[model samples]
Target: MNESNGHFRPDKWRIYFIYLIAAVLFAVAGGRLFYLSVVKKDFLQNQGEIRAVRTVSIPATRGMILDRNGEPLAVSTPTWTIIANPRKLWELEQDPNAKTTPQTEMDRLAKVTGLGRSWLQEKFEVNRNKAFMYLRRQIPPQDADEIMAANVVGVSKRKEYKRFYPSGEVTSHVVGFTNIDDAGQEGLELAYQSSLQGTPGKRSYLKDLKGNEILRIGQDVSEHPGENIELSIDLRLQYLAYRELKAAVTQNRAASASAVILDVKTGEILAMVNQPSYNPNDRSNIEYDQLRNRAVIDLFEPGSTMKPFTISAALRSGQYTTESIIDTHPGYLRFGRQTIRDLGNYGKIDLETVLVKSSNVATSKITLSLPQDTVWNLDYELGIGSPVGIGFPGESTGVLPSRPKWHPAEIATLSYGYGLSVSALQLAQAYMVLANDGYKVPVTLLKQELPLDGRQVLPPRVAKSVVKMLESVVERGSGKRARIPGYRVAGKTGTVHRVGSKGYEYDQYNAIFAGIAPASDPRLAMVVIVNDPKGRKYYGGEVAAPVFSRVMEGALTTLNITPDLPEGLREVRLEPKVPYRLAQGG
Candidate 1:
């Protein structure tokens, strides 16, 4: 309180010092503000945006799979995936102001999700420190809405898809199923995955302090929904084939079975089914073995079903005709240590009679006389030992022995379908050649606008002659059971001893039948294979041919094909039509 002036006055130096301090402070603040607002503006703004902006994925819907008739085979249903931020949920439970605990909300969630309370508790405990966890996957939309309406803190639901197989196990092997992520896993679903799958889009948005979306920044990419697939399969024929094959399998007590039907002219698969099929929709107790598409994936000896091909090859050689006779004396022939035998001594018989009797001895003689590679070339042209070209997964090209030099015994065995192997699909395709007048059309699963162009493999006259000869087999030979009323049926039967770890199992056999319907003007070709029948009737004619008869009758009628056989000549079908619901899917 020192007074320098005459009156009481503050110190002049102290006032000047206070003003200088004020100027310096203001200058520093102004400089810092200028630096932040102008010089460092872009960098600071980017950092701020980084903290506030969030990117989210916009899910795309998966495509549907339909039959040729527009019936749904595989479909994607809108579902939800429940997710939770465990840390946030735990924090909410600890907050005193919170109205409900995580446990209570979780209990509510469990009831709606069909999950046990103990499971939810375990999940909560296991992921308590984690920021995110899946609560339940692929729950119904209604259930998800109920859970979201509860507003259980960090718990939220995400839109997703669940694959549903409308035809269930009937069409499981063909249409296949998708994983929880909506990605295909098997069958046509896996084959056309890229085309059927959709591209997901991205969206950016501004989030608030509480992690709520404050503003949408617009999508960077537009979502592209998956493309729909329409298969060549006819659901009615698929159902018919599946029912008949399953019934035969159960009746024969077979280990497994497969059947395939095709449009002879178009080479389009109309129906394909396998026994012991697993439901694509429910896989809780699924067996991996049952998931195989045996029709296209499994290989077996085609047996006498190859006889027609041998005859066709022989006829094409110009050395033989339908009337060419082969002698099968004593019913057996010795090729070194291996002896090829027929059911009985068929004496001297014409080529048509050889097929009717299915005489192995006669076939071996015919094959031996033909030029080398004649049968092999014909088999190759017929798609034997080749992929069916339907783009199915794990399709076996089958085993066609290609050696620099072939043994006479090897040729004989191949003539009887022992050394070579082929899939049910390949067998069906080969028969399609005969049905389509020797033209080799490319087989497919996709629907066609018009019949695709086909390459000629055999002379049309030869094909027609074989088709006519096959009719006699169904009429009086081992394939009598395959005879269908009001239709001139043409088919061949095959019975092969299943090869095991050591050699062919004498007791176990594969029964097979392949044929065409309305033989006068063939339209449909089919093949049925039953493996390891435990019943007494294991022969192709006894077991597989019966299934062929029923399915062919139904398919012919369904297609509205004209009955070629006169009413007087058409015998009354002794077997009653099996009762079934057309709603079943294959």
Candidate 2:
């Protein structure tokens, strides 16, 4: 009886201990539940939501670029990108009867996406283990639809933006182009990229078991559209300038060419063109040489075209007058080890004659007589060797050596426009100073709200004198080819040898002409540059001047600018032969 009772007692104690442990566990569990519901409820809810939701980015539309006439220069068009889920593709590959071979899969993708089979194969093979992959971008809508319709488990299509240039290479230099990601990469596109790139927004929604969006759980953030840019370029003038310049390039068999037209009153760039151009739509096959915008990017010595500025400076400083005379004899002047020579020998001439003849010796003598400080100051005021103030990418500040760096020979060389470098735009701007009656307007690619209020870089009288001299150039000097039949054109011709890596290439030259039309009251300023013409005639007068005449004539006529001369007045013919005279003593 005692043994049985002891065993029963042990069992009873075990049961009691078990009950106490159960009660303690239950209390602990209740406390844990309360803590979770009160203290960590928000954290637990967030963790649960994180596992079920996915976020995505939506790209915004880029802005359109329009010309001064409201013509589209650059625009965005809808496109599609193809994405593949590798896991789905892998599942298909595992099926014995499924299209498993990379070749077959790539062929199918290429057929639907319009990409090459080998290219698609390489992309597909890049990471076979990746769950998602971009098969192609920039696919046309029709092609994208076809690919999506194939219902390949992993493949999907998303809308994207692609850039389109309606004018193609005709306005490439000014309108510029964007990259694959629809971001501006050059020209005006890049200059105002931030303003032209729109903001992207986000949307969040709840998806059901089948992945169909069912309920909106959160508010969507709206996107901000990019602002459109209106440029100062006149599309008609741009087309005219491009056609004329391209014709000149082809006719002369030149290496390249460029032209720019600007409004004299507003400094608005009406048209800008560069030949040997590339279609932004097909940049993949473009040669680097063909893509250069020579008007702003390339620099060359201005040759005789720079004579006007030097003469104007001398006139403004009271160092000379229109009637000021210098003795130039033997047609040659020796400075240091170099001897500068004129086209021919002349005894003596006045400032007007010096400019009319574009005499190297005479101009050198004049520049040398001026104080070095005056020359340097004049150059700076004229915007030489300085930024053009036009917001263009890859613009060059043409080299204008400091006065202290000048060698005696350089003074003579610079006088005739050989030792100094200036971009085509710079030359045009300098000529504009004379056209605008001494005011130096900042060059711009944007349309002005009002007529430009320019800085006075030269006295009005001095500028007038230079204009008269430039008029003489078109009338009786080397720029005679630049004259229009009904217009009083004023301009200068430049022909300079191209500097090569080894040295100056004697046969290679850049032919240039900068001018303004209806000289009685200037309206438009233009510059034309033809590089390395292999034709029989390579001179600026022969090659570039005619282009200037054609383009300027068309531009003026298109803009309805009346001729300065009366209806009955006959076109002025170039003087048969102006008496050659040297103004500086050698």
Best by lDDT: 1
* Residue range 13-104, candidate 1, lDDT tens digits: 77998999999999999999999999999999999887898887878877889999899998777888899877877777668998888888
Q: Residue 483 lDDT in model 1?
A: 85
Per-residue error for 224 in candidate 1, Å, reads 2.4
Clash pairs of candidate 1? 170-586, 171-586
**TM-score for each candidate, following the candidate numbering:** 0.88, 0.88
**Lowest summed-lDDT stretch of 10 residues in model 1?**
577-586
C-alpha positional error of residue 338 in candidate 1 after TM-score superposition, expressed in Å: 1.7
Error of 1 at 158 (Å): 1.8
Clash totals, every prediction: 2, 4
Residue by residue across 67-104, what tens digits does model 2's lDDT show?
98789999988899988866556556667887465456
Model 1 RMSD in Å is 7.0
